[model samples]
Target chain A: EPEVTQTPSHQVTQMGQEVILRCVPISNHLYFYWYRQILGQKVEFLVSFYNNEISEKSEIFDDQFSVERPDGSNFTLKIRSTKLEDSAMYFCASGGRETQYFGPGTRLLVL
Target chain B: AQTVTQSQPEMSVQEAETVTLSCTYDTSENNYYLFWYKQPPSRQMILVIRQEAYKQQNATENRFSVNFQKAAKSFSLKISDSQLGDTAMYFCAATGANSKLTFGKGITLSVRP
Candidate 1:
């Protein structure tokens, strides 16, 4: 089965530095999403992207976060300034319908 | 805002036994989708099964089945003949007309040998 793929399975960055997480969604998927889970917390929605624009975002997705579909296959999430609390497992998902398929996830640790 | 609640934080079952994980949600939308995802120690999210709110028939995938009660706003997962591989953190999630998924805190299931 085709699945969503993400790059840099794990990343460590300085607290004030910028970080970009990349994902390659399934080729035929039209909708993409980003979600994060703190070490011991529930998964939280970050943003949803469709037609090269943001469809919806959560309150947690503030000024520091931005998503881009720079190419037909690549979808990236950029954090302008990482905070210690920004450390978490970030997941990328894509879907043609209601069921979204998820990637393995990228573990981001901002120290 | 929509919310998913998994009342059981942890559960254990003997190998080959049947186990049920409870999940309930509060949603105002009449049409939506419910899902059960499994994350093992590897922390990789895996879609186990899904149920559509409009469908009255419960959704089942092999040994994994769901008891969905639309009126009560309940969707629970039942794992039959549980194996050791079934040990994982299970999350119940719901999505309304919007595509965003609201997930429950999760329930850890340990299938003992």
Candidate 2:
């Protein structure tokens, strides 16, 4: 089965530095999404993308966050400035019509 | 708006036994999708099963099955002949027309030998 792939499985960055998490969703899936889980918290939705545009975003997805499908295969999430609270496991998911599949996830630590 | 709730924080079951994890969701949309995702110690999120609101027949994949009650807004996962590999954190999630998933605080399930 084809799975969503993410680069830099683990990353450590200094506070105030910029960080970009990359994901390659399933080739044929139409919808893409970003979600994050702080250590012991429930996974929170960040943003959803479709038709080359952002469909919806959560309040947590503030002005500092941006997502792009820079290429046919790559979906990237850029955080202008990282903070300690931004440390979490970020997951990328893609779906056709019914089910969405998830990537292995990238663990980001802003120290 | 949609909210998924998994009331239990953790559960344990002896290997080969049957275990059920409870999940209830609140959603205003009449059409939606419900899912169960598993994250083992490896920290990889895997889709265990999914249920579509329009389908009255529940979804079953291998050892995993779901009891979906559309009227009550309940979806529960039942694992039969549970094995050690079944030990993981299970998350219940719901998504409406917008396609943004709302996940519940996952429940940790441990399969004892």
Candidate 3:
């Protein structure tokens, strides 16, 4: 079965540095989303994208975070300045219907 | 805003036995979707089962089934003939008219041999 794919399975960056996590969602899906889970915490929604625009975002998705569909297949989440608290497992998901498919998350560590 | 709650933090079942994980959600929307996702040691989130709020008939996928109580706002997962491979972190989630999924704190399930 086709699945969402993400690059750089593990990312380590210095605090205050910029980091970009990349994902390639299922080709035919129209909606994409970003979610994060702090170690031992529930997964929290970050943002949702459709038609090359953000549909909704959580309070946690502040100015430091931005998502882009730079190409037909790539969805990227950029953090302007990484913070220690930003370290978590970031997941990318996509779905044409109500059932969204998740990718093997990218573990981000800002130290 | 919707919130998913998984009351159990951990559970264990002997091989071939049955295990049930509880989940509850707070949502006002009449139409929505509830899902159970399994995350093994690999940390890959895999969809185990799904139930549509509008459907009264519960959804089942092989050994995995759900008891969805729409009126009570509860959706629980039942795993039958549990195997070692079933050991994982299970998350219950819900999404309403908006597509953002609200996930419960996952429950760690260990299927013992």
Candidate 4:
């Protein structure tokens, strides 16, 4: 079965640094999304992308966060300045309908 | 905002026994979808089951089945004849209401040999 893939299974970055988490969604899926889970917390939606633009974003997705579908297959999340609180597991997901298939997730560690 | 609640934080079952994980959601949308995702130690998210709110009958995928109570906004997962491999964090989620999913805190299931 085709599944979403994410890069840098684990990343370590200093505070105030930048990080880009990449994802390759299923080729035929139209909608893409990003979600995060702080240790022991529920998964929270960050943003949803369709038609190469954002359809909706949560309050947590502030100016420091941006998503891009730079190519037909790549979906990326860029954090301009990482904060210590930013440490969490970032999961990239995609689907044609409502049920999203998630990637293994990138564990971002902001020191 | 729609929210999914999994009241049970952790549960355990003997191998080959049946186990049920509870999930409930709050949503006013007329149409939506519910799902159960399994995240094992490998940290990979796998779809265990899915259900459409509009459908009256529950959905089943092999040993994995859902009891979706639409009016109550409840969707619970039942794993039958569980095996040791069933150990994982189970998350119940709701989506399609706003094109985003609301997930519960998750329930950790441990199967004893």
TM-score, every prediction: 0.99, 0.98, 0.98, 0.98
Please provide, for model 2 over B71-111, each residue's C-alpha lDDT reduced to its tens digit, 9 standing for 90 to 100: 99999999999999999999999989888889999999999
Tens digits of lDDT, candidate 3, A1-111 = 899999889999999999999999999999999999998888999999999999999999999999999989999999999999999999999993379999999999999
- Candidate 1 residues lying further than 4 Å off, grouped into runs, are none
Winner of 1 and 3 under DockQ = 3
Judge candidate 2 against the unseen true structure and give its global Cα lDDT, from 0 to 1.
0.94
Please give, for residues B1-113, the per-residue lDDT of candidate 3 as tens digits.
Answer: 89999989999999999999999999988889999999998888999999989899999999999999988999999999999999999999999988899999999999999
> How does model 4 score on DockQ?
0.73
DockQ of each: 0.71, 0.73, 0.73, 0.73
Model 2 over residues A1-111: C-alpha lDDT tens digits? 899999889999999999999999999999999999999888899999999999999998999999999999999999999999999999999994378899999999999
Per-residue lDDT tens digits for candidate 1, residues A71-103, read 899999999999999999999999833798999
lDDT of 2 at A86: 97
For model 1, name the residue pairs that clash: none
Candidate 1's TM-score: 0.99
Docking class of 4: medium
RMSD of candidates 1 onward, in order: 0.7, 0.8, 0.8, 0.9
List the candidate 2 regions with Cα displacement exceeding 4 Å. none
| Model 1 C-alpha lDDT per residue in residues B54-75, reported as the tens digit of each score | 9999999999999999889999
